[model samples]
Target: MSYRVSVTTIEKFRRYMTEASTFDTEESLLDSIKGFFLGNDKTKFGEAWGKIIEEGHKFKHVSGNLNGYLVDGIFFSEELARPAVEFAAAHPKMIYEVPVAKEYEVNGMTILVSGRTDGIEGNITRDTKCKFRTPDFQEYVDSYQWRFYLDMLNAKTFYYDVFEVQGFDSLVYDKKGIAWLHDINIIPYEPLYCSSYSDMHDDCKLLLRQFFEYIEEKNLYQFLKPYKSNA
Candidate 1:
């Protein structure tokens, strides 16, 4: 049987499988894999801060939080997100939210990875992240998104538009948790200079091979479900 995968999906699988996050079971991770492949909301609602940061990219900031910033009906750090969106929008040539995709064959199984990027300018691609602390740049360095998107767009470089955020409590309790935003620009940790696209293909093929082996050995295929790609 074949599987549809995404760079994000592989990262999610790897994160849950290796990291010390709350979802610490094979069952939950399988469900997460299924959810991501099927575009279910499992990953979205799991945490609030990440979702808040993502939503913060949607629009420019308003002057004051007089009404209090609410996401999913709960107060969140809207101020922390303002600088990211503002700076992200400042690029005149950059187009936000571009779709990219490709298919691969790994160990006799079909794998399709697809997703939208944060922005692309000419041959340049950029992904934005808003964080409460200084980022471990290695995380971006080790990501699959840049390589995949770079090759898909046949782009020059992928940049991480990381923003640092710090919280400032409001005088009123309910209106608290507003934050200050600092923009940090990053060069590509792994620059695809020659653009062989072989490293990416080989890396993806290996990941799928290992992933499939795990599924087969653990008998978790039942959780993967059927996927029909939009292509």
Candidate 2:
């Protein structure tokens, strides 16, 4: 049977390769690794912010009440949405929530990689990230997610639109004790044209093949267990 995986999953496997021994069983380890892709509070807020930005970009030409178009009320407050909205207004050409997917054959196994990019404009693909502190641009460049997006989209440039919203006075952060203002910065890095692009692609494929082999070997034991549970 063919296995479906995403770039995020591949990245998680790479990260937890050495730490899998921490889990009690292979099934538990797999479940915990899968949890990395699940939505959490931080990701939820980032999605909300991205939605507000997309809405603002879509309706930038319209006049009158923009608040009605923006995401507001309990979930998304004015403070949190303001900068994203403002940024969207400034750059109206950005296409939001673009879905990109592609399948590859690695070591005789079908690997399906897919992701929804935050935005894409011209030859550049952009990902909006909200964080409590400034992020390292090199980390973004080195990330498997970014590399996958670049390869799938065939994009020339990749930009990380990082919104450092540490000090925004919102109810979301009332008790968290984060009170230092930060700025939104767009850090652009060229991926496809990089000197190490070919090498990186080779490394990713090898890592993925190793992951699939490990999973298949582990699952074989489950199938060959002596006793089966009736419950």
Candidate 3:
């Protein structure tokens, strides 16, 4: 089946469909990181930020078209559109967009998830990634952000594809501490998520759920107790 998403959602996380998570508190330094990224387009970024402020923080911009590549609305080279079209042509399975919970509020502070899923198939859900530069394995792992999405879906397994075009040359070391690089086409074998992967993803869900509960009830001290002790 064909698919489409909000232009805002599609544009917001131009790199990945979703972000990592919302700020822990309004004073958190995460805003700085956001500023750094959004600063890439000073003109558009300023306009958008001004809108956010003017709207009394009630509304934020988001894009729905997350799956498609971020190319000009026109296809200048058959060489370029070839891959995007090829992917859709090959994956005849119907794709769909799913809204998974990520954002949460802590003491009137909005802390939500920072990511979105491109779409889902019968068993394999998919995300569209356009990487101009090579993505290390850690970068690849980070892209999955499976913990958040899987938690929302309450599923055990998932399959993802990373579509890369020229520029990537290095690999990233995953948490398991393995490093892998891309030497051939970006579309390598699908990463398999065994039971171990499921358990880890489930743990993230539990973490977020507990975090939301604590914040929703105004339990900041108790909510941050664990982190403080660990630190």
lDDT of 3 at 141: 60
List, residue by residue over 112-151, the lDDT tens digit for candidate 1.
Answer: 6777887677877877664444556776676666777776
Give per-model TM-scores: 0.64, 0.66, 0.45
Give one digit per residue, the lDDT tens place, for model 3 in 1-231: 111112222223323223433522333322322333342322332232222222212332122532222221111122333444455556656454556654333334334444456656675555554444444545546443554555456665565554444533443445644332233243333443422263665455444444444344653433221211111
Candidate 1 residue pairs in backbone clash: none
lDDT of each: 0.56, 0.58, 0.39
Ranking, lDDT, top scorer first: 2, 1, 3
Clashing pairs in 2: none
Sort order, TM-score high to low? 2, 1, 3
Of the two candidates 2 and 3, the one with more favorable lDDT, higher being better, is 2
Error of 3 at 136 (Å): 1.9
RMSD of each: 6.6, 8.4, 15.4
Per-residue lDDT of model 2, residues 40-104, tens digit only: 55565566667778875442221243232223222333444566667778778988788897666
The residue-level lDDT of candidate 1 at 115 comes to 79
Model 3 CA RMSD to the hidden true structure, in angstroms: 15.4
**How much lDDT does candidate 1 score?**
0.56
Error of 1 at 50 (Å): 10
